[model samples]
Target: MKENYTILAASHISGVPTESIRAWERRYKALTPQRLQNGRRSYSTEDIEKLSLLNKLTHEGHSIGQIASLSTKNLKNLYQKHSPQRHPLAEDLIKHLHDFDMEKISEIIEESKLTLETRSFVLDFAAPILSEVGILVENEKMTIAQEHIISSILRSHFGTLLQISANLKPQKRFIFTTPEGDFHEFGILLCAALCLSRRIGIHYLGPNLPAHELIMATKMLSPKAIILSVARLPKDLQKVDIPTYLKEVRTHTSASIPIFVGGDGYRPRSSADKGIQFLPTLAEFDKMLENFTK
Candidate 1:
């Protein structure tokens, strides 16, 4: 089944702003959405692909006036011209996905590990390929099963990498997890692998962790910090209440322990929630680790 997403979700998936989507609809007739009886715009995966293409082209110097009406295929052809090197490794991984060649996927991942340094492997190559797989799945170019296969294989790769350095004494420690509503584990796993690369110990508690359980673990482990990852936000406008969940988690933990929240779905908000800091990307996370250790 083709996936249908809300405008907000589309904004996140396509890297387009909600305001821009509305403007494009009203002004440029970029792409029409299916409207509900209540007047909410439901964006299809195809709509997301169009918006994503538009967003990529605009970023690469194309004007909306010139390309907003173009088909998704045409926009993609133009985008490749602009971002010729967007993700060189991404294409091969995606191709392997389409072919159901898990062995070749593992070969590419392992080769990346041996050729690139840990940070480059994780940030530059691994991250981009996984993100592209996510896009392919989101845009319906790949099956959900294919996405899971890629993720599971990569997860094993990361596990081996993390284990090799287990004997190294860590300079800092953190507990990485997601709340009960967020089921994505790859984000935190990647985060853990990155931290491990820097000799930063991470007590990673996979996903769907309850707040009370997290609070209990915090008390038991007394980690230097907590890193909560949220990979998806609620699509309903009325349900975008993740801040409340952030606050609830904060309430159960110590004010002195810095809690960081991040992932694709995180929205920018005031860091007024005591001890809750948002690190939106791995680069920012590296800076955070550097600053914390300093």
Candidate 2:
């Protein structure tokens, strides 16, 4: 049986303009629809679905050029791996840290075997545990030097995983950096480890990148995605000019490349914000990547 879709059918199904669809085919070489004997272009069911997902992501601020390159299977797989799981370890890790129980932390680390297990231990457990340690420091429950001891241990664990994952295959380029004055990189490094497991190439820019440098780097590398880590909300974020900064990057880029904003700083806003997508946590960002491709 032959399945076919007309221009209107494709438009209705994809929520993309028929003319824009045609233009994409012409300019971007996104899809190659067959022409029927009567001279109308006919799309297959697979083509329609791919176009639909592509349209959704692009409309939500991803680039069409990036979408064109992603296979539907990869897109679906990416989303599935990222969906949330019941991470009890995360809760337990926090509890232990609040009590300053070093023995419990050491015990859990010894019992965990897999890399994802370790990742879960660190992200779900250790990271939040560290957060509690910070609170303890603020209240003078723990001294600065003690906090450093725990922090160093967590960094060592993260570094170990990163070193192993770096040896994997089929690397894709990822640009990671914190915005100016936002010196936090722990979360960014964790996210990088996850990307590395999938064999994504990483070009971590570390902390405190100037906005202009970020734009310049984007222009230079033209990476598939630019992950901007906002560890702490800038004072400027409260001002109106933040939107202008976001728009500047959008105007400068020719590709529909996605700009993924993550960290504790930015809250999720409505999709209509134009250029930015706010992801509250690494877990949420990981889930969204399941459907993201290009």
Candidate 3:
């Protein structure tokens, strides 16, 4: 029942030249369009979106040869990071943050909550703003205190959203939390928000929980899965060893319950960790959740 577009239609919609699309397809295997009975190429809606994203990134100076292989989700994230135009509301919020207008900041966030759908508010609005604020702090354009203030505001709002979503009919329930010493929680908070938006129930245990305590919680809850976000690196790897923590949790918990880890802190091992799946992006996580429900 899905519509298919011809190469010319795909080009018109995606803004990529037919020649370039073919070249990317042949050279980089960027997309494999279906061949109709007459041997004409047919592209689906997803293919068109991917082409559009590729066209945008390529125009922004990315090498097609380099980026053609990246997932559409990664491509979108890259575009978000490199785009010249920031989201208007995010830009306004950032300006207010610089002025330290606490009241105005709260008002803007509350306004966003009311105006945008839960998913858009979290992923498209709140996520980007948090990421931009981190950059501001790194460049010293904003202080740590300002960063914390906005984080606190977003966190409080997310908590309220979580409670509201908890009452929805859940497709699956997962335990969401951050490990000890990984106090940076926005990544997990955003993930939790994304999950909740889809009626996925989250048993959110707040940050800085020790490994053994996580095992105990897992045993008690027996959730569909356990998801941890390790966005911030610990000062001492020896003290907050990810491999050790994962091994401990795996050994103690039931093998039937899968463990998913996300964020920048944990790297995928050369040999993938047993009984664990690493979802590196929010888009990928959402896709996996879709597959789970199906």
Candidate 4:
């Protein structure tokens, strides 16, 4: 059976706005979507692929009016001509992401790991893949369950990667986790992967580590640094104030141990915050890693 998608779903999957999709269809006849019984537009998988190609070409400087009626094969040739350096697996992985084909997704990830070096795999492939899936989730194109499925697969692979690298001439070690109220793990997981690629030993404590427990773990592990990821929390879901939480962790932990925090939910709200380093992006975190090694 062929799959059919509503205009909104097509927009989400194809990275084209609904307004643009309609404009292209109406003005240029770029696509001819099927009309449902109630007269709503429904796109097919093929239509989405064509739209994705068209979107890519338009962003790369092609005029929509000039290329709207090209065949899919011709559009793909144009895409390659324009972006020859594009990762080979990206388009395939995105298709599988939308299709929810877990096996294919895992296969593509494994293939990329084998083909690219650790740093390249993380920067070029893994990071982009996670970011795309995250956008899909944020746009409501994918459900939380789908996000969890991808996360679980990535966590298992990254855990293994971290363990293998940490055993090989590891330098400074860092403890990675989220606070008690924050349950998201993807941010820290990617961070840990980057650290591993740099041969930085990581004792990943996973997410939602209570302040007290984190203190105890810190004492036992005595890592060179502590890294925390705090994702955005709805008001009703917040268990403790972030500033207070940071204060508690700082107070109990050794003053010498540097604490680095990152993610969307953290912003130093007041002057009381001290001894906490906020890294807003992975690039910043990597820079900190370089400083530690020096």
Q: What overall lDDT goes with each candidate model? A: 0.77, 0.66, 0.81, 0.80
**Per-residue accuracy of model 3 over 99-199 as CA lDDT, tens digit each:** 99988888888788788887778766888888878866876878999999988888898888878876776757899888787777887788888878777
Candidate 1, 247-281: lDDT as tens digits: 88899888888888877565433234556776756
Clashing pairs in 2: 63-256, 78-290, 79-290, 90-124, 172-200, 172-201
Question: At residue 22, what lDDT does model 3 achieve?
Answer: 96
Candidate 3 lands at a TM-score of: 0.70
lDDT of 1 at 155: 84
Clash counts per candidate, in order, are 0, 6, 0, 0
Alpha-carbon runs more than 4 Å astray in model 4 = 1-88, 165-171
| Runs in model 3 lying further than 4 Å from the true structure | 1-61, 64-86, 165-171, 234-238
Candidate of highest lDDT: 3
Query: Candidates 2 and 3: which is better by lDDT?
Result: 3
Q: Write the per-residue lDDT of candidate 2 for residues 87-156, one digit (tens) a residue.
A: 5554555456557788986665555534345436645556555665665686686788767766887777
265: Cα error in model 2, Å: 2.3
- How close to the true structure is residue 192 of candidate 2, measured as C-alpha lDDT? 76
Lowest-sum lDDT 10-residue window in model 3: 264-273
Q: List the residue pairs that clash in candidate 1.
A: none
**Which 10-residue window in model 4 sums to the lowest lDDT?**
264-273
Q: Considering lDDT, where higher is better, how would the candidates rank from best to worst?
A: 3, 4, 1, 2
